[model samples]
Target: MIELFGDATGNSIRAAIALEESGLTFEPRKVALARGEHRAAQYLQLNPTGRVPTLVDSDGPGGERLVLTQSNAIMLYIAEKSGTLLPSSAVERARALEWLFFFVTDVIAPNAQAFILSRDSTAAHGDAVRRLKERAFALYEHVDRRLAERPFLAGRVFTLADIAGYTITTASESELRWEALPHVRGWLERVGARPAVERGRRLFRSDA
Candidate 1:
């Protein structure tokens, strides 16, 4: 089985959701970020950045254990390996990749910036932080419009794009009001109805 080292939110939940949706059994190894476990020397060897959600596959492409870092990358790997949650047609596949990129670049990027600025950065960064938060909302509005046309980001199939976007978006539910974005709210509910999605959502949030 694969070993997933992660905490409860952000990128960690994204990868866990993909693993569950793939129907692959993986061992979830909790890394207590509050205790600086992610900064430990032992963990740093696997991930130089000492980030949560590092995946260690005992058997990889050629029998060697694969050490993969990055949330979306891990999600994509799981989707491709399991042959599920990926669009079949070439056009749809291209669209799926496009949305995944949007999630990583537009959605996740601004949200991460806002988070760091709000929690760790000084008040001097307030202007930049506000800008990032605005950008995130704008990108979400774009996604809402897209969802109004199609059931899923890549059309009909539930692809990695949805997994990536949904995880990040919900991570900030306290800040984002889904009432205005009816399409996005509906999509979140629709995806949340999945067994795997709910399991993944609770993996890092057992306390909730």
Candidate 2:
């Protein structure tokens, strides 16, 4: 059996969306961050870093059990296992990786740093946080420009790049200048409309 332990954070949602899109059957285990569940001994045994979005697969390659802690790694594993979420063509596959890392490193990393800084009360990091956020937001303009040239982030087909882009864009929706990014706004609408994406977004809801 495959099990995914996570909350509703962007990283977790990205993994859930990839699993859903790849048609993988896995149990969704919610890790309550507010309750400090992720740091519990049992959970820490599964993830030494005390982070959410850990995946455990009992029937991994050659029947060996697999444990994956990183969200992006889990997405790639799903894609590899299910033979989806990535294009078969070599060039398109490269494009998917390019755009996926573009969002993960360029966009998501800065915002994540800003979030950490905003939560730290021991120091005055307002200017640093603001600068990080500005840098992240400015990168979205490039995503908008790219979307204007193609239907999806990695060209004609939907791939992991779209999953990463969709989750981060959704997380930053209210803060973004949507009116100026028609292409990104439209892409968001399209990606959000997917059944898998919709279900993934709610996988860790209180009611769910």
**Clash count for each candidate, listed in order shown:** 0, 0
True-structure lDDT of candidate 2: 0.93
Number of clashing residue pairs, candidate 1: 0
Q: Per-residue lDDT for 9 in model 1? A: 73
The digit string of per-residue lDDT tens for model 2 on 100-182 reads 99999998989999999999999999999989888889888888899998989989999999999998888888889887799
What does candidate 1's lDDT look like per residue over 1-208, in tens digits? Answer: 6988998977998898899999888999888898899999999999999898899999877888899999988988898889988899999999999999998898888889777887863357778888887777777778889999899999999999998888887877777767678999899899989999988878866484
Compared with the true structure, all predictions reach lDDT values of 0.87, 0.93
Which 10 successive residues of model 2 have the least lDDT summed?
A: 199-208
Provide the lowest-lDDT 10-residue window in model 1.
117-126
Name the top TM-score candidate. 2
Report how far residue 101 has shifted in candidate 2, in Å.
Answer: 0.2
